[model samples]
Target chain A: DAMVIQNPRYQVTQFGKPVTLSCSQTLNHNVMYWYQQKSSQAPKLLFHYYDKDFNNEADTPDNFQSRRPNTSFCFLDIRSPGLGDAAMYLCATSTRESMSTDTQYFGPGTRLTVL
Target chain B: AQSVAQPEDQVNVAEGNPLTVKCTYSVSGNPYLFWYVQYPNRGLQFLLKYITGDNLVKGSYGFEAEFNKSQTSFHLKKPSALVSDSALYFCARGIKAAGNKLTFGGGTRVLVKP
Candidate 1:
């Protein structure tokens, strides 16, 4: 199946320790996004990669960064994870079109636990 | 500032009963709406979307949403609710000028009783 996949479905990281979550898509989409979803909360967009162009949300904390080294893969790096960073990290991909009508496909998500 | 609001934090419905999940939005221009379902410990699955055309858009898993431009609402509906339908539902709207980023609602947890 051509779907989005995320590594380490459950991640355990110590407070102030750096961690990385990985995602890859077989869909071959040009646009990939990263979202943080807290318990019972909405999935908030952190950043995305339109090909090599990385776009970060203005309100996204500086500690979160993303890298799209190639077309099929994207990585979310937590510089120093905190307790508040404990959440489900979702990776989604969509075919890029200027029309903005395409729907996004999501991975199963990484549940991050910062202790 | 585009946004989506799911009025109820949770909705309880009995199996085989009709269900409605209300959603309202505020956007600068024409709205592009979407509905997604999230099972426990999983990512959201796209259910349906309304960009243009028909007011009633049918989507995956026998789900549908009605886009009412006059009322600025897009409510999800199912004729016969099932126990497996229990999950967290989120409504989202796209901001074209914002690089197609989707602003999601707080999410409404749906509980279908047997």
Candidate 2:
């Protein structure tokens, strides 16, 4: 099936260490997004890539960065992992159009644990 | 600020009974609303959306939602709830100016007792 896929369903990293989560999509969607979802909280948008243009959320922390090396692959890099950064990282893809409602498809998500 | 709100933190329903999940939104201009479901340890699955046209929109898994512009509400509904329907439900609104970014609600956990 054409779907979004995430690697390392569970990840463990030491505090202040760098970690990377990966995502890929077979849907060929033009837009890819990364979101941070804490336990019992709504998934918050961290950043997104519309083609090669990166759009970061205004309130996203500096420690969080993302790269879309290509259309099918995107990576989320945590410069320095913190306890607060331990959360489920979700990757989503969507086919965007001018002035249209686009439905985003999501991956299973990576559960990050900062020790 | 554009936002979506799920009033209830959790909803309990008996199997085979009607299920209703409430959602309200505060956004500028015409609202584009959506409903998504998330199972434990999994990503969210798109259920339904209302951009324009009919007030009632039917979606995956026998689920439907009614969009009320006057009430600024889009509530998800199911005629007969199933045990498998238990999960976290979220309400979201699309922000056109923000590259059609989705602003999601806090989410409501649905519990359908068999």
Candidate 3:
């Protein structure tokens, strides 16, 4: 099965410290996305990468950044983690053909706990 | 702007009974609806999606969703619920004409009694 994979399922970061969450996919989809899902809330889109082009959401803070060196691997970096930054970070991938159908496949999320 | 809504925060049903999870959406153009399920500490698994041609779309785990365009609703249904079906259900919608950001509902926690 071609599945999406994430590293460091559970992470604890000190306040003001930096943290990075990684995601890799076997599906080799054309687009990759990062989402932040807080407790009991819908996941919010932070950013995404279509092939090598990066697109950031409007409300996403500057503290967050994403890097996709290639198609298989994507990384999310949090410059300075705050208590409010504790949440589950999800990574997903999708593809668009001529018809432009978007169906995303999600990976197991990284749970970040900031103290 | 595209958005999705799950009216019920939680739903409870017996194991052998039918189950339904409600979802509604708002979008500029035609809507692409999707349903996802999440177990404890696990990633979300795609249950089903409604693109076109079919009002009742069957998906993984014996789950199906009906697209009601007039009511702007896409509710998930199962003929017979199972205990393993208990999980967090999320309704998501995307407008391809606009952008790719999938607007998701708050999510509904379903509990199937044994």
DockQ scores of the candidates: 0.69, 0.68, 0.55
Better of 2 and 3 by DockQ: 2
Best by lDDT: 2
The residue ranges of model 1 lying beyond 4 angstroms of the native Cα positions read none
Q: Please state the interface RMSD for every predicted structure, separated by commas.
A: 1.3, 1.4, 2.3
Score each candidate by Cα lDDT. 0.92, 0.93, 0.89
Off by over 4 Å in 2: none
Tens digits of per-residue lDDT for model 3, B13-87: 999999999998884567788899988777788999988897989999999999999899999999999999999
Q: How many Å off is the CA of A78 in candidate 3?
A: 0.4
Worst 10 residues of 3 chain A by lDDT: A95-104
Put the candidates in DockQ order, highest first: 1, 2, 3
Encode model 3's per-residue lDDT on A30-108: one tens digit a residue. Answer: 8899999988678899998889989898999999999999999999999999998999999998885522247889999
Q: Each candidate's root-mean-square deviation in Å? A: 1.2, 1.2, 1.6
State how far residue B57 of model 2 sits from its true place (Å). 0.2
Q: Which residue pairs overlap in candidate 3's backbone?
A: none
TM-score, every prediction: 0.97, 0.97, 0.95
Error of 1 at A81 (Å): 0.9
